[model samples]
Target: MPELKLAIDAMGGDNGPSVVIEALINSLKQDTTTQFVVVGDEAILSSLFSQFELSDHPQVTLVHAEQVVEMTDKPGATMRQKPQSSMRVALDMHAHGEVDGVVSGGNTGALMAQAYFILKPIPGVLRPALMAALPNMTGGRSYLLDLGANPSCDSETLFQFGVMGSVAARVLESDKNVSVALLNMGEEELKGNDEVRNAAQLLGQSEHVNYIGFIEGNHLFSGRADVIVCDGFVGNIALKSCEGLATLIIDELKASLTSHWLYSWFFKFLQKRTKKSWQRLKPDHYNGASLIGLRGVVVKSHGSANATAFESAISHAIKEASHRLPEKIQDRVESVLLEQH
Candidate 1:
């Protein structure tokens, strides 16, 4: 009856089914029209559902999965070995007409591989990218793609990511003229490697994309670009480094403010003032990464996501689904590719 239905991999992440169930339980309250097909151990999920008083919730349904994909499992191995995993089951459901999208907090590699095999990439998409949203200084968000999907990419692949990412960003932002940039070593034209330089050339020649040239690491969160593109190797390292730095900054601030007994009271006061600022830096608030260019909406959550974080992942899937993101991206990518011919 509900137009939006999502398959959730309940047993995917570090904390297990409880977090996913809890997020689903809370989500049901806010959005009654959305249906949830939760995949995991039946016994464990039943208990969790009962514990959260969601046992008979009309919108929720539980589907059992025999095997659980581990964090360390190789992508290709998991695909061959575990066919009945929660992640696999969810993806299977999405690939078919059963569910509109999938949200999983499981092994990223396994999820990607399984999704590639099951859902497959949309026509004209070279490779699907792991695109994440970062809070920018301009009170908005910037999208960075190929976070860890493909470590190396050619100029054509990199150029495709820009087209796909811009379409992806349009789903969230109201603006169609989203700025695209290449994450480079420097702003200078000759600073980066061959792949990046060639990609820049392709992007600049494109009339479809609003190419903004190059963006340095320092300007990643400065709102210089709406969609930033790079190969997985550089993007993954840069993203992780930013996350690590954000954590360290928060830890240092907390330590400094509450180190002495005299400062404890003042620290508490300062914390209230800085809570909003800290939230922007924390990964918990923005835990979902869209696997763009896929035939279906598949959101990858942080492995260690809590209930709040997992809820954000679910929301990401729903938002993308509502916008018909894959179709929009396909249209844009085809338009760009056609112009080059």
Candidate 2:
């Protein structure tokens, strides 16, 4: 049977070992063949496992760590001071080839910093990007790249994001003729600041990218573009805005539904249908973001992820590991780099 070894940061995330433990148990239940190395305080994990009556999970292995990296602490100091941190331990396991892939709900900056420094770029990859698949009402999803990697990038960077995002879309969604668009203030050729204009020009010249011109913020869910490329600063803002808006909308709807006596009775049935329809909109539904262009697959999950979210992240990491996506991405990106030589 094909096997996948996953290193999970058990001490990370807001819920700590409870969520991580549950996620591991849940994932193992679905795929008994998969194995996990829980990198965190072994005592805490063991206690949680026993408390949850999950001692029968044979696929799990415990790896000990003495410290936990708090979300607020400086990543550099934590990396040096606490070498046994769950995040560091998990990354180290992947770096040493002890594990096929790693999943973490730890600090984003810290995880990225450690992974990039330790693993480095995949030979010729200039920069690594973060890509996420967003839910759309049109039954098709859209991909956003550089969601929080590079804060400010140039035209070449944006063009590269196009290629990277396009490749991911093809692999994840099977969209061959994927349309790439630059996130801009307007759809016109002459629009926005100099950065947008420059990126537009560069994307226009890319033969590898099916450049579909500029995309405004509102166009994110329009299903008109397959891949949207922008610097991390802009992309992060957009991602956060979407998340905040979705949360606000969901909360308001729930509040309004249960506000009255008659509505409260009907709310239960309505909620079931509403939740089913809005399942894809939840951030936790797709918690893992692929760290593209790396030599190895690194999946970043939300720091506040719960058990279900962590489970989803692990599944995602396993998929990347099974396919050797990082290797394929490296080969493709290196080929492009070599052509420039």
Best by lDDT: 1
The lDDT per prediction is 0.90, 0.81
Best by TM-score: 1
What lDDT tens digits, residue by residue, belong to model 2 across residues 143-256? 898988889887767777887778777777744578999999888888887877887886787666788999899988888898999889999999898779878987997789
In model 2, residue pairs whose N, Cα or C atoms come closer than 3 Å (at least 3 residues apart or on different chains), thus clashing, are none
Q: How does model 2 score by TM-score?
A: 0.92
Encode model 1's per-residue lDDT on 1-341: one tens digit a residue: 34899999999899988888888877887887888999999998888888887788888899999899999888899987998999988998988879999999999998888888899999999999999989889978899999999999999999999999998898877655799999999998998999999999999999988998999999999999999999999999999998798789879987887899778888888878989887786677778999999899999999999999999899989989988898998898889878988
Please report, as a residue range, the 10-residue window in candidate 2 with the lowest summed lDDT: 332-341
Off by over 4 Å in 2: 52-56, 174-177
Structural RMSD, model 1? 1.5
